[model samples]
Target: VLDRQGLDAFMRQIRSKFESSLIQDEKNERFPGYARRRWGGALKTLLAAIDKV
Candidate 1:
């Protein structure tokens, strides 16, 4: 778990579109295939920053 590979695996283990659209896109602009760049990047960056902290 010291490297990014472990983190990626962790994400894959828990990630799920079925979790909820609100979680998948916090801003609630889209869901599933409708999600766009800003929403996708926002979620990724949020997770990355949290992992760093």
Candidate 2:
């Protein structure tokens, strides 16, 4: 039980970090045009799904 709890906490931390990174990438305008536009919408969708999980 303890191991499972620890793993769950670790997974949550990783998810949080991933969400933060995605947000930062969306805000960064220095990326090439294709990446900037394409990834922004995709990442937002992915983040929403992650939140649901």
Candidate 3:
């Protein structure tokens, strides 16, 4: 099992990866804003659950 510090680091890594992908998608101009909204909400929910741990 991961300690608190490890969990925090993992969360930061996950967040960084998510943000980078979102930025890349914006640069590619492939997905629409509505799609991004859906994805962002999903990520937020996932992160919230992680925080509970």
Per residue, candidate 3 scores C-alpha lDDT tens digits across 21-47 of 656676767564644565566667667
| Tens-digit per-residue lDDT, 1-53, candidate 2 | 23555555655655566556656676776763544345555656555655655
What's the lDDT for candidate 1?
Answer: 0.53
lDDT of 3: 0.66
Ranking by lDDT: 3, 2, 1
- If both were scored by lDDT, which would come out higher, candidate 2 or candidate 3? 3
Instruction: Give the count of colliding residue pairs in each prediction.
Output: 0, 0, 0
Per-residue accuracy of model 1 over 1-53 as CA lDDT, tens digit each: 34677656555543443244446566665454355454455557647855894
Backbone steric clashes in candidate 1, count: 0
Report every candidate's CA lDDT.
Answer: 0.53, 0.57, 0.66
Q: Which residue pairs overlap in candidate 3's backbone?
A: none
| Residue 46, candidate 3: alpha-carbon lDDT | 60
The runs of at least 3 residues in candidate 1 whose Cα sits more than 4 Å from the true structure, single-residue gaps closed, are: 1-35
Give the better candidate number (1 or 3) by lDDT: 3
**Each model's Cα RMSD:** 7.6, 7.3, 3.6
